[model samples]
Each structure stands twice: as structure tokens, then as C-alpha cells.
Target: MPKIGLIGFGKAGKAVANVILQHPDFTLDFVVRKGLKQEYYSVRDFIGVETDDPALIYSIEHIDIETFLDDHPVDFIIDFSSQESIFYYGESAARRHIKLISAISHYDEKTIEFLKHLSQKTVMFWSPNITLGVNFLILAGRILKKIAPWADVEIVEEHFKLKKGVSGTALKIAEILHLEDEQINSIRVGGIVGRHEVIFGFPYQTVRLIHESVSREAFGNGVLFVASHLTDKETGYYSFEDLLGPYFQEKENDGLC
Candidate 1:
């Protein structure tokens, strides 16, 4: 079983913790957050679930990352925190051959280079959008574009009002389909989790590919999905498309209908 370490305890992290514990194929090691009154939190008690596993939570401010990692080594580190969180676990994790899965929405070019650099020493994957539905939408959009290269395309993304500007996923879809800036649209309103759609306009009709994240569990599910596939992979940089592409190989060979 793969031992997992989580770097964020936010809503998505909580949901993922539940998912990881519930999975029989993996084990939850520990969670690292900035500050906490307690030295450690019982995963089962904190999450209100019954489990024999002794997963715990530790505050980043209180623990020495290197020492903690050495004593309780983890197979993979799931990062849902800020892009800068990489600095906290990057070199240490790479030295231990720990895999990295970063789902942070955005990162500067320098941080991105560091992520890629760490891949040389460990299996690393960086996907701003790790939800399976969204990546499926991206893959489906790419295949459809091949069939309808002349189809005029428009991309629209909607998120909660406080979600700031266009999501990295939106820009990713736009980049995948080779759409212009003006062709991409963004709407922020209400508390909608997230929704992204690509419309292909044909002379007679239009086709749309859409994916909406209704809950944070999708993040955990996607992580599990990717982690299972990477178990035997060699140290290198990877993407969701890389792991998911093989599943569509048969379809691609069949002409992607």
C-alpha cells in the first residue's frame, strides 16, 4: 500500500483525507498545515470516521519537516496548498524519492521550473485542474477539434464570485484548442464551485463539452486515479494528460470517433 502525506487541511484536503482513508489500496500518513494548537490530530477522530489506521495531522510551524519525513517516510505527497508550499517539501521529498502531486491552481514560472527540476529525482505531476471530469473534457475537446478543425470555438468558465479571474483550467482549455484571448469568456457569480465548457460552432449546429466540479471529493478521486497509475513510473515530470492518455489510446487508434 502507498503511504500518503497531505500538505493542506482546507476543505478539499479534508475531503481528500476521507477519500484516502476509505481506500483500501492506500494509507494516510500525516497532514501538514501552518498552525494548530494541538501537536497532532487523530485522523479518524478529527474526521469523525472509524479507522484502525493511525493517521495524524501536524502543524508545519511546530515540526521539523526533514526530521518528520525521515522518521515517518511517505510514498507520495499530495499538495493542495499554495504554490509556495513546494518550497516546504521539495528538496526533502526529492531526496527521499517521494512522488509529488501538486493541484495548486497557479504558480509562477520560477516555481514551475522548480517543480520540473524536482521531477529529475522523483515522480512529479503538476496539474492545476486535477478533477477527472475537467481533464476528460479537455481530452474530449482535443479529439473533437481534430474532427472539426474548422469549427469556430468559444470557451466559457464560471466559478464562485470570489474566485477571482479566469481559472488556469480555462486558460488550459483555450490553449489546447488554440483559441484566442477574446474567444475565452469568464463569469464569476454565486457560490458555484466551478464549471467549464467549450462550444464548437458548426454551420448547422453546435456541440458542447462541459465539466463541472460539484464537490471537492473529485480532487481526491482524481488524485487516487493518477496515483494508482504512477506507482511503477520512473522519476520524471508528468501531467494528467500523460496518465489519462493511455486510457484513450484505443479510441485514438480507432480514429477518436
Candidate 2:
């Protein structure tokens, strides 16, 4: 089992943590959260699950980054903690030659550049929206556009009421599909985790590609996919698309089977 460390303990983080805990392929070593009050509680106890796993919870408020990484080594570190956490642990992770998988959701170009530079030291993938179904939707949407270049398309995203503004995923899709901001629609209702749809309006037919994230566990599936594919990969700064794109290959033939 690959030893892993998690960088956040919020709603999304906990959901991913639960996925990791329930699985048998990965051994979750530690989770680091800012302002966390507990230091030695296993996720099993913390989440009240019946398991003997040794996943501990750590707080940045109490532990030094370098010493913590040294004391508790891991094969890979998954960051769902914060947008700025990479700056704190990037060098340490690189020095230890640990793979990095981040789902920070948002980052400035400077932070992205930092990840690129650190990639020289070890394997790293910075997935902004690390959901398997959503990424597949992105790839499928591209194929649909290529197949029907004349079709008109619009992007629509919906989230919970507390989420403000258009989602990053919607913006990314719009950019990939070459659509304007006005062509993208945003809707916020009660506690919808996330939903993104691409509606292709052809002259005679309509095509819709949708990915709905009912729970954050969808992210764990993404993590499992990335980890399985990336374990033996050479060091580089890869986007989520980089991992999934190659698998979307086309088989050439003149006739259908």
C-alpha cells in the first residue's frame, strides 16, 4: 500500500479522507490541518469508524513543516487543505522525493509556476477540479465539438446558494470550448455540491454532456485514478487533463464493429 498524507480536514478533505480510510490499497499516514486542536487522533477514531488504520491528524499551528515531513515520511502528499499550502511544503516534499497531488481549486500564476519548478524534483499533478466524471466530461465535450463543429454550445454550472459567482470548472470548460463568458450560465440553489453541463444545439438534434458531483467522494475516485496512473510516471508538472487525455485515444477503422 502506498503511504499517503493529506493536507486538509475540511468538508471536502474529510470526505476524501473517509474514502482513503475505507479503501485497502492506500495507507493514510497523516492529515495536516491549520488550527487543528488534536495531534494524535487516528482518522478512525476521529471519524468514529471501526478500523485499525494508523492515520493521525496534525495541526500546522503546532508542528513545523520540515520536522513534520521528516518525522513522518510519505510516498505522496495530497493537498486539499489550502491554496497557499504548497508554498509551505513544496521544498520539503521535493527534497524527500515525494509525489504531490493537489486539488487546490484556485491558484495564481506564481503558485502554478512554483509547482512547475518543483516538478523537476519529483512527480506532481495540480488538478484544480480533481473529479474523474468532470474531467471525462471535459474530454467528451471536446470530442463532441470536434464531431459537430457547426453546433452551437453553452456551458451551465449550478452550485449551492453559499457558493458565489461562476465556478472555476465552468470557466475552464468555456475556455476549452472557446465560448464567451456570456455563453456560460450560473445557477446557485440549496446545497447542490456541483453540476456542470454542456448543451450542444444542432440544427436537427440536441446533445447534452453533464457531470453532477453529488458528494465529495467523487474526488476520492479521482484521487484513486490519478494515483494508480501516476505511481510510476517520471517527474513532471502535469495537469489533470494530461493524465486523462491520452486514454481518450481513437481507434482508426473504415467500418464499425
Candidate 3:
């Protein structure tokens, strides 16, 4: 079983932990978060685990992530944490020769450059959205862009009210379509998991591509899929799209209608 360290304790992190515990191929070694109050429930409860083995349910405060890693090395580090967390521990993970998979978004140019630099030392895969369907939408957007270069393109994204900022998937689609000048409509409404739509408008026709994330578990499954595939990959920078080649090829071979 591959040992894994999970960073962050948000919805995505909890979902990933839930999935990891059920899978026999992976072991959840440690969870890193900001702080743990004494009155709070144990790490097992935080991660929604029923049974408790102290070793299996260990939680490391963010400040001690490096120390925990030094004593209990992990083969893969999955980060659903903030950009600051990525920047802080990325180089450390690289130096330790640990593979890091990040699903964080809203990166400035400087942070991206830094991540690219870290990739040279250790295996790193970064994606704004880890969901496979979102990546397929990206691929579809790229295809549509080629077929309709003259069409005006726009993206609109919707998420739960608690979600802050625009959808990184929408931003990424805009980038892929070279529609940098295009505006993205980001809606924060009630109970929405996620939804993104890309529209191509020409003089007389319109093309639309859409993806809806029904639940956070989709992202957890996607992360698990990515982690499983990284066991044999060489050290390098990888995008979510880079990991979709096989899936796309298989679809093509099946003769998509």
C-alpha cells in the first residue's frame, strides 16, 4: 500500500480521507492542518473514521508538517490546502523526493513559476480542478476553439454560497481557449456543488459545453485516480490534462458519437 500524507482539513480533504480509508491500496499516514484545539474531537472524528488507531489517525499541526514528514515519510503528499501551504511546503517535499499533488488554484504568475521550478526536483502535478469531467471539459473547450476560432467565447460558473471567488476551472478554460479578455460569471448560490459552462457564439450559431460537479466526492475520487497513476511517473511538472491522455485515447478508440 502506498503511504500518503494529506494536507488540509476542508471539505475536499475530508472527502479524500473518507475515500482513502476505504481503499486497500492506499494508507492515510498523516493529516496536516492549521491547529487542533484540545476540546476538539480526535483526528479520527475529524476525518470521519469510525475506528481509531493512534498511528492511523495522527494529525499534525501545519507548523510541524516538516517534522512529521521527517519521522514518518510518505510516498505521496496530496494537498487541498491554501496556496500559502503549497508555497511553504512544496520545496521541502521536492527536496525530500516526495511526489506532491496539488488541487489548489488562484495562483499568480510568480507562484506558478515557483511551482514549475520545484517540479524540476521532484514529481509535481498541479491542477486547478482535479475532477476528470472538468478536465474533459477543458479538452472539449480546446477542440471547440480550434473548430470555431472566430467565435466569441465566454464562461460562467456557479458554486455554493460559501465558495469564494471565481471557479478556477472556468479561468482555466478561458486560458485554454485564448479568451483572456472574456469575462467569467461566477455565481455563489445555495447548496451548489459546482457548474461551469462555456459558450461559443458566432454570427448564426452557438456551441455550448458544460460540466456539473454533483458532489465533493467526485473530486476525492479524481484525486485518488491521479495518485494511483503517479506511482510510476518520472519526476516532472504535470497538469491534470497531462494525466487524461489515456482516458481521452480510450474514448477516441471507442468512437465517440
Residue 25, candidate 2: alpha-carbon lDDT: 88
As a whole number from 0 to 100, the lDDT of residue 228 in candidate 1 is 93
Give lDDT tens digits, candidate 1, residues 26-77. 9998888876843487877888887766688888988888999998898999
Comparing 2 and 3 by lDDT, which wins? 2
- Residue 68, model 1: lDDT of 91
Better lDDT candidate (1, 3): 1
Error of 2 at 244 (Å): 2.0
Q: Tell me the tens digit of each residue's lDDT in model 2 across 151-257.
A: 99999899999997678888888888888999999999999999999999988889999999999998987887888888999998888778877676553653321
How much does each candidate deviate from the true structure in C-alpha RMSD?
Answer: 2.0, 2.1, 3.0
Worst 10 residues of 2 by lDDT: 248-257
